[model samples]
Target: MPSAQDIASKLAYITGQLTAGGTNAQMKAWYDEYKKLNVELKEAKAMQKKNPKDPNDLQDPKDLNDPKDPKAT
Candidate 1:
């Protein structure tokens, strides 16, 4: 099975081919593959989000830099 990046690359390539006047058969094939890959990528992302490896991996509110702070200068 191809990784998400690989699938994305293939989808991009197919899009370029279609834009360059690819045949109908090629367009159909690529559209199906693109849909499959898009779903797979979304599912993978959802799973990853559900079970992150590190608790601290989440965004931290303190990480934001306040622009109005006098000491920011």
Candidate 2:
């Protein structure tokens, strides 16, 4: 599986392709992948929100990587 950055970058690429008039088959494939990434992103965000290490204060992701994050560091 690709990293989150990989997935995100590809999603962006696909979005551009769609806007630039890619074939229907290609558009459909990319859109499906984009939707999958959206799901993963949503799950990662939800986990972070629900199980924050510090409810009152949160550290930047660079300083602290939450284990619950689905996006592998």
Candidate 3:
């Protein structure tokens, strides 16, 4: 049960790894792994709808607010 922050962190980590230079084969492997993680994060987020949050639950952080957001950059 990953929180939104956890998903964001994972996305950032993988993005950094891909941008960091690597051999073609190594990049391919990272890409494949990244894809898997992307799917997992999506699934985890979808589950959030089913398990209603408690009244005290924290709100999700908007990626758009990030200064380094891809669209912003």
Best by lDDT: 3
Clashes of 1: 0
Q: What is the lDDT of residue 64 in candidate 2?
A: 62
**RMSD to native for every prediction?**
7.0, 8.9, 10.3
lDDT of 3 by residue, 4-55 (tens): 5687687788789899969999889888878977887788677666664633
lDDT of 1 by residue, 35-71 (tens): 8878877775665578655343344455556799888
Worst 10 residues of 1 by lDDT: 52-61
Predictions in order: lDDT: 0.66, 0.67, 0.72
> Best-fitting candidate, measured by TM-score?
3
- Residue pairs clashing in model 1 are none
Pitting candidate 2 against candidate 3, the one with the higher TM-score is: 3
Clashing residue pairs, backbone N/CA/C < 3 A, model 2? none
On lDDT, the stronger of 2 and 3 is 3
Candidates in order, TM-scores: namely 0.53, 0.52, 0.60
